[model samples]
Every structure is written in structure tokens, then in C-alpha cells.
Target chain A: MKIAVLGSGNGGCAVAADFALKGHDVYLFDFEEFNENINAIMKNGGIFVDGDFVGFAEIKYAGHDIEKVITGADLIMVVRPAFGTKLFAEAAKGYIQKGQKIVICPGSCGGSLIFKKGLGLELEDESIIVSETSTLPYACRVIAAGKVHIYIKLLGGIYLAAIPSRLTENVLIDLKEVYPGIVPAKNVLQTTLQNGNPVIHPAVTLLNAALVEREKGDFYFYEEGVTPSVGRLMEAVDKERIEIGKKLEIEIIPNPVLGLIQGYMQESNYDTGYSKGRGFKGIKAQSKLDNRYMNEDVGYGLVFMSELGKQIEVETPIMDSIINIASVIMGKEYREMKSRTPETLGLSSYTVDELINVL
Target chain B: MKIAVLGSGNGGCAVAADFALKGHDVYLFDFEEFNENINAIMKNGGIFVDGDFVGFAEIKYAGHDIEKVITGADLIMVVRPAFGTKLFAEAAKGYIQKGQKIVICPGSCGGSLIFKKGLGLELEDESIIVSETSTLPYACRVIAAGKVHIYIKLLGGIYLAAIPSRLTENVLIDLKEVYPGIVPAKNVLQTTLQNGNPVIHPAVTLLNAALVEREKGDFYFYEEGVTPSVGRLMEAVDKERIEIGKKLEIEIIPNPVLGLIQGYMQESNYDTGYSKGRGFKGIKAQSKLDNRYMNEDVGYGLVFMSELGKQIEVETPIMDSIINIASVIMGKEYREMKSRTPETLGLSSYTVDELINVL
Candidate 1:
């Protein structure tokens, strides 16, 4: 199958290389501002894959032209941070063809909804299918410009759902070719709530804001940062998220349980599960508070959950609290920013039943 | 002058010794559960003073008997943590005589009001003058039972106020003898708003919750635990506190400016003012999340400010956020606990003007 990957960062490079290595035609593209990795990949002719999937896979195309990348693609994957979703979607709007599929790998809370709106399409438009995954399929990184490292390929426990409930299976069938563990979710809400980065990242980062700035995040984030108090905070956020899911009639798995299933943890408890988790053994925290942990997770992810809770009448005091503190730490009012709130997703007046029916 | 110092902890011992050294008859009292320090003082017949003030000071009495401690005392200084204000007030209720002045050394947000309520006295009842100070005059600690170390006796910038406002001068006159830097406040609200612990303690502690747990608070709290982001959080809380004070027609000095005026900081910026503050130089953080930094500061201080903001129609989102997160970290609902709030202090129904009139 011909595939178009619309980001050349860590996840984008890994996704592009993984499919290219599987003998599929892969075209990688990024914004011109991020041409460092694109230029390197063009010169090298492909991305270097290491660890779980080791090889140098050749790409059909790598450049700044979105038209060349997505015109004849069988599948399009938008792999960018949550904040970049709208930018990428807007960039691809004029070129998006009918019946084409675009999946945001690891939709950080309602990424599909945001992407659909950014593409100037109604959420219920059936001419094109837009979907999102619960999480990225690989714990990977771009070691250098065109060199990528795949720590793990995420053997199981990834959920995918289209914007419209009826079309989730169609997207899952296409995604399963690359991710055998990809499962169809009830709707995009399930995929959004099931993504636990919002539940864990902001809580851990806000609680460790000073430590990260002081030590320049020299300490292992999961091992030393996930103390009992920090775990309790994550639990508080996770409880609010699960409550929001219950209000929406979506059964969301707790973060620790999901961590265990995803092979990220050996235990199913918040504290020791992450602290002693085999997968998170050596991940260091970001050296500053302005990183994606608080900005993307709190601004986009938690703000989305908190607004959804407000619409559905499920109290999310903990999520709101984390958003408030994170906003202060980042010197921005995240709640007021409306980066990915219900209103921003064009669901401000959405009734619980209406939301359930639509999504 | 005859002085009774309630709570034989650090502040209590320091106050008792300071007055005794000035030739006033000092009597120290505490609950029997904390008879260790009381018993030590009883055995030694005095408290050993060190640091800024170095000398042996005689105490008129030291025991757990409240009647003996309060009877015939011209002035009573309640120097316990904010949580103990009510307990100590209830203990001194039966022995509190007319015309005697009782002052909570640092009214951790409406301490005088809680103390008066705990004494079963109507706020307007002026039989005994109930007063409070903006903060403790000395940054001192009890090195051991019957031994106290005075790090620095503050030379200026302490505000004192009485319940009726008119009688503030009377308490100020007596307190000024020991706390020469003390000045009169507009009301108890001024004293409450001027206290900076709620602005600094919980913000810094919550931001460093995991580090405190992992390191057992081995680092210098102010110098190391405080960073740019932590200072920003503190500044946010301080802004909310000042807004609450403004709604009540009380002019509150910003925390960093107050810290400079009180000699706790050489610089007047929140970030480095705390990180490099000469007065805060070697103070260590609490070894656990369950310490008074959160309990006394958040439960009593931030909660009171938040509740006051609610009653006065002033927004305190940051204060409320810190209270919510601290409640989760401590596993207690601080807002619902009513440990200290406008309702608990009998100011819940007051309008802004009425609240200003009362305080």
C-alpha cells in the first residue's frame, strides 16, 4: 500500500520507516521550517531504524510538498504533537482528496475532531475518513537527523476509532496491517480518553517542575519522580478521566492497567508500577517546564477533558486543578486559551446524548 | 508584664524565652501529648536561648495546665500552627479574663477569627481583646526540649490587629515591647492577607512533592527547591491573595516585597528572592507530604483565602487550584474539610462592605 506520513519527527520517521521496511511505498513530508530531518533523510535516501526494527528503509519521496506526498497515498498518517495537529491539518486541507483516510497517531485528546475542523470539513462528512489512535505504536525517537531508534514497537493495546462511530472498523482494518494489535474503539471519545499521556504527563511534570529545572532533569523521570504523592496525583487525574468516560458511556481503562497491558509496566499500581516499570527504566524528564509535557498535555489534553466534563456534568476538579497550576507554571492561561476545548471542537452546545450520537 | 505562651513548639519556646529575657514573667503551656518540651522546661526551670539572643531566661511556669498558664496573665500569645489555634483557644476559654489581650503570633489567614470562634465568643464580644500579627517576629526553632535557637529577631515589618479594630492599638502597644518592629493593621483581614506563608509554602511544597518524598527533604528548601517555575506558581498564588485583600479594601503587599521588607530576602523578585534569600538560607523542606507546609498552610491558609475570595466575589483560581492539588497530595479534601474558611470563621454571609466593617 502507498502511505503518506505528514511529520518527519520521531514518530513520523519511525512510522514511515516501519512501513517502508515492510515493502510498502512510503512518502514522508514535513513543514519547510522543519527541513533539517527532511534534508538529512533526502540525502541519506531513507530513515535508519534500530532496536526492535533494525534496517535502513528507502522512501519513495521525502520533501516539503504535501501534494506529492498525499495525492496517490492509500493511507495518510498525521504524526505530530497535539499542538501541531491543527497546523498539519490546515496544511493538508486544499489537497485532501475524497475517500482518503488520515489517522492521527496517538490523538492527544480529541485530535480527530480538531483535525476534521482544521480541514474545513464537518465532523460527520463521510466523503473522507479521519481517525485517531489511543497512543503511538512505538516508544521511539529520532536519534539524529535521519537516524531513528525504536525502543519497542508496542506489541499490543492500541485503540483506533474514526470520527464517526460507523466507520471505525474501516480505519482499523487499514491500521491493523502495520499494527496487528490495533483494536476498534466505540468512537473517538474512547480513543481520546484511553490516551493516558494527559493523565500522567502533566501531573508528574507539574509536581516535579522545580526538580526538573533544578537538576536539569538528570534524574530518571519514572523511577525517581513517581513517588507516592505523585502517584496519588496521577490517580486523581485518572479518576476524573474515568468518571468523564463513564458519563459518556465509554469504559476507559485506568492508566496503570493500560500500562501493564502495553508492556510498559510489570505491575498494575500507580506508584510502583511506573517507578519500577521495565519500559520506563531510563526515560529522563524534560530539562525545562516549557516542554510538551505541560504545554501539550495540560493545554490540549487536560483542558479538553475538563471541558468535556463540564459539558457532560461530570466533575473534573483534579484535571482542572492540574490545568490551572500548569498554566501558571507555563505563564499561559490554558483554560482560557481554549486550545482543544469542547467549544474549540465545535461541540460547545453538544448534549451528552447528542455527543454520544454524533461521535 | 505577665505573658502566657501557648504551644511549646518552636515559636512558643522562642516567644516565652524572649519575653522572659526581657524580665517579663513567662509561663509556657502545651497539650499533654506534647509534654516532652513542657516537661523539659519544667525540669530545667527555663529555656536556653542561642543564636541572635544568647542567654538563660527564667519561666514563671511550664506545664500542661491551661488554668495556671492563663490566670492573671496580662497578655497571652498563641504561637501554635494554624491547626492548633482552635485547640489552644478552647483550652484558654475558661481562664481568659476580661481586659486581657490574646494574640496569635502569625494569624495564618484569620487565625484570630478561628481562635475567637473556638473560644465560643461572638466576634463582636469585646470582653477580652482578641488579636493577631501578620507573622512571627523571630525565625526561630526549638533545638531541643528547654532549648531554643533564634535565627534572627526581625527588626521591622510585622502588622498586628485586633477584632474590633479600635482596640488594635492596645494589643500593638503590648506586643511592640517584644516585637518592636510591629505596626498597626487596618483590621484582622489586613493581618491575615499580609501573612505570606500561604503564598509560598504550599506552592513550593506541592511543586516539589516528589523530591521531598524521594530525598527525605535533604536539600536546602528555599535555595534548591525553589526555581523559576516554582516562583511563578508562588507569584500566581500571591496575586490571588492580594486580589482577595483588595476586594475587602485591604492593601496587601506582594509576597516578594513583603519578604524584602521583613528581611527574609535581599532581592525583591519571586524566583531568586527565595532561591538566594539570605534569611531562608539553610531551612530544609518537610521530609514528607503530610507536614504543616500543606496542612497548616493549605488547609488553613490557602483554603481561608479561597473561601474569602468566594464570599467577596473575588476570583482565586490559583489559590483554589493549590488547595485542590494539595488536598489530593495529602489525601484530604481541604475545601470541604472547612479546616479554615469564611464559613468556619463566621464571615460566610458578609458582603464585602460588611466583611470590611467586621474585620
Candidate 2:
């Protein structure tokens, strides 16, 4: 399989490295950050796969120069955060070759939908299999400029059903060799609702702000910070998310449990378990620096969730409160911004069928 | 003449000393935390007073106990930050002699009402004349345990208004001898509406929390922190206050103009002319350990003002927004607290005629 990765950050580089190591032609396409990593790889021509180590193997191409690297690629994975995703999608729109797969590594539930919308590509626009993973593999980072460190790439979570579902088999066939862990869910609605960031990040961050601001030592995010008071707030937000998920019948997991399933804890519920902050089990979490969680997750993830909750007649006081608080804390007025709402995400008034078709 | 000072803090101690210095019979009551100062004052005789260099003379009477303090006093001023006034008022209820004057030194806008209501006294409770001043007499603090350090005795911006206008002249005769600066207003409405704390505190604190948290080093409370954004928030609050004042037919001066009238500056409005950062000359800037504007002003004063605005059908979105925002920042659900709303203050259900009669 010939593959290329967009974004050289934790998620992007890991995808590129993993595929290249698998004896497949893999290319990493980022803006310019992949250069030193590419340079180091050019010398050794192999990525360091440590955790569950496979072996060092050669990747053919890794560079910021997207066009030259993306040429003749079977699959192109864009791993940028939500903020840069739109811009990267626009660039890819012009470069996409027919039959190529542009899988948004964990389209983060809504990334595929967001890209599709941003490209002005409607539900009918069909040329490529634009897919998403539930989460990226490799809770990983670059140990040095050229080195890739792997931390047990998330083994299983819900990815997306191809927009038409007719293309699901094709998407799975192309990426399964690279990520055997990918599991297909119904649509973007299922994918997005499964977004754990909105459910986790804002709840953890808002509850632990004082601790983060004061001592700022690593906090057991679920155990120490999510007190009963904070838990009630989370439950309120979760109720809204769960209500939306049930309406869509996506089987969304509660946040702390999701962390457990993701191999972060020994237990799955807030009452008993501990989340050792964002670094999943201190195993080098694969999440981006300031990407999907704040933007797509909370931005698209929570926003759409809240909007849908409102549509389905669910009260989301805690969710709205947290979103508004984050907005102010971030020095932005999110209430007036459309980017975080269902209306903006093309889900506000859509019938589920319309949404599924659109996604 | 006999006078009892209910609270032995800066305002209370200063009031006790000022009257005792004039050779009037005076007594001061406070908690035993002031054991050292009280013993010293008992030995040294009374509070130290000064004019222009003919200064620091101990006057008379260190009546540390309540029974000893209230004995034979013609007038007793309940001087405390709205917190202790209720307890002190209830304590005084048992000891207050018939027809004695109880003047609330700087009665917070609703203090007289709270006091009267606490005693189960009727609106026409005229035996004890309740009055309030716009502010305390001296720019002071109790530096030591019992002794107050007076910086400047403000002889201006003081308004005294009795509960029943009938008792106005009777209260003034004694007040004149003690204050020599009391400018009588029509009633408690004028005095209460003249509060400057609510107008200044919320705007400064809410907008400057980051600065306050970042640099506790030499930050001016007034001049530096009250920026344009603070001014806008304050102006909104001030307009609400003035609208309430207008509805009640009292001209409560806005903050900037009040500063000018108090001889601080010649600024007319809060928008531009009044510069913050440098602070009022000779008056110690209110840079307390924590910016207490949230608790002291917003919680106490703005709650009063916001409620009053509600009674008058005045729109106070900005004021409401600040109060709500500050309450969240403080981690309290203050918005739903009725004591925060005008209805709890008896103004919500009051007819225009009833308010006039109560005042």
C-alpha cells in the first residue's frame, strides 16, 4: 500500500512511521515540520517502533512538500488538529487523485463531516473514500527530530462508516493492513457522538483549572479533579451527549469508562477509577497539542452534541455552562460563534437520514 | 451627650473617638480579639484624635463591653460592613432605650430596611430614628488590635437621612455636634442610593482578575485596573443605579462625578475623564489581599443595586452579566440566590407608595 501522512505532529508522524515500517511505500506530508524527521529517516531510512516493537523499516518519502510526496499514494491521512484541518482539506481538495483514500486519522467523529462541509463537497460529492478513525494509533511522539516512539496505538474504537456505506468495505480494505484496529460505525453522527474529547477535556479542564493554575503537577484527572460536584456537572453534560447518542443510536460510552476502554485505567467509571490526566496511563497519549479536543471535539464535538441535545429536547445546562466557561476562559465569545453549534455543523435541523446522507 | 459605637473597627472606633473627643459620654463595643488594644485604651483612656498638627490626643472612655458601652448613651451608630450590622442590631435591640437614636454609619443602601425588618419592627418604627451616611468619616483602618489609624477625615460626600423625616431634625441636632459635616438628605433613599462601592468594585475586579492573579505587586486598585472595559461595565452598573435613583427621585451621582464632587478629580462621567491606576490622593487604594470587590461590592452592593433595578423595571444586562460572571468565577451559584435579587429585599413587591413610606 502506498500511503502519505499530512501533519508531522504526534498523530500524523505515527501513522506515516507505522505504515512505512510495514513494508509499504509510506510518505509523510506536513507543512515543513517533517523535514528533520524526514532528514533523519533519509539517513537510516527506518522509523523507531519501540512499544510492541515490530522492527526498524524503511519509509520511501517524508517531507513537507505535499505534492511530490502524495504522488501515487493509495491512502493519504491528514493528522492536523481541527484548526488546521480546514485549511489542509482545502489544499488536498485540489490535489486528490481519483480512487485515493484521504482518511482523517480519527476524523474525531466530526472531522470527516467538517472536511466534507469545508470543501463545499455536499453529500453527493463522490470521488474518494473520506474516512475517519475513532482515535489514532500510537499514544506516541518523536523522541528526537527523526525518531518516532510508539505507545500502544489505541487497539480499538469506533471509526466512521463511509458516507455512502457502499464505500465502507473499500476504506476498511485499504487501511486495515496499516491499522487493523479500525472499527466502522454507522455514519459521521455515530463517529462524532463517540468523540470523547468534548465529554472529557472541558469537564476535566474546567474542574481542574485551579489545580492546573496553582500546582499544575500532573493530576489524576478523573479521580482527583472530578469530585461529586464536578461529577454532577459532567453527568449533566453526559446526559445530553447520551441522549443525543441514543436518539442517533450510536451507543456512546460515558467518559471515564471510555478512558478505561482506551487502556488509561483499571476501572471504567468515575466512582472508582482514576485518569492520570491527558497522558493516557502516562503512556504518551496520541492527542494533538491544541487540536481536535479544543476545536473539533469541544468546538465541533461538544458544540454539535449540545445543539443536537437541544433539538432532541434534552436540557444541557452543564454542557452549555462548561462551553460558555471555556469560551470566556479562552477569551473568545463562543455563544455567538456558529462553529461549535449543530446549526453550523449541518446537523441542527437535519433529519437523521438527511444527516447520514450528508455525512 | 452620650454615644455608643457598636462595631469597634475603623469606622466604629473613629466614630467613638470623634464624639468622645468633644467631651461627650461615649462607649465602644467589639469582640475580645482587641484585648490588648482595649486594655491599652482603658489605661490610656480613649481614641487618639488630631487636627492640623495639634494631634494624637487620647480623648476618653474605652467601654469595651456592650452593657458598659450602651449605658446612658443618647445615640448609638451601628457601624460595620453590612455583615455584622444584623447581629449587632439584634444585640442592640435588647439594650436600646426608648426614643434613643440608632444611626447606621454609612448604612449600606438596604441596611436600615434590614435592621428594621430584623427587629420585627414595623415600617413606622419611629421610637429609634434609623439613619445612614453616604460613607465613613475618616479614611482609616484598625492598624493595631483596638486602635484605628486615621489618614484623612473626609468632611465631604457625607449624606445623612433619617427613616422618618419627622426625626430628621431631632437626629441632626446630635449629629451636628459629633460630625460637624453631615449634609442631610431627604430620607434613607438618598443615602442608600449614594453608595459608591457597587459602582466601582464589580467593574474593576471582574475585568482585572488575570492582572490581579498575575501581578499582586504594586498594582493600583483604582487608577490602573479600571480600564476602558472596566469603565464600560461600571458605567452600565452606574446607569442602573441612577435609573433606580431617578425612579425613586433621588440624584445619586455616578462614580466619576462623585470622585470629582469628593475633590478627587474634575471628571464628569466614568467613560473617559476619570483616569484610574493612580488612585485617589491620600485615600489608601483598596488593594486588599484578595480583590474583595466580588464579595464586598458585587455580592453585597451590586446585589442591592441589581434588585433595585429589577424593582424599577430598569434593564441592567451588563450589571447582571458582571454579577453572574463574578459569581461563577467565585464558584458560587449566586444568581439563583434570592438574597441576590430585589424581591428578597422587599422592593420587588413594594408599591411606589410603600417604598416612600418605608424610606
**Candidate 2, residues B1-359: lDDT per residue as tens digits?**
77777776677777777776677777777666646556666777776644311234353456556877776788888888876667776776667766878788877656776776666677677877777777776656666755676655654667787776657778878888756767887677777778787777666655445334334424655555444445555676777788878877788877777665554455666634445312243333344324445675777777777777777676665566556656655655555554434564456687656676666
True-structure Cα RMSD, model 1? 2.3
Clashes of each: 0, 7
Best by TM-score: 1
Compose the digit string of candidate 2's lDDT tens values, residues A4-27.
778777676677777777778877
DockQ for each candidate?
0.82, 0.07
Question: Chain B alone, model 2: TM-score?
Answer: 0.87
Q: TM-score of chain A for each candidate?
A: 0.97, 0.85
In CAPRI terms, model 2 is classed as: incorrect
For model 1, state the Cα shift of residue A139 in Å.
1.5
Number of the top DockQ candidate: 1
Query: lDDT of candidate 2 vs native?
Result: 0.64
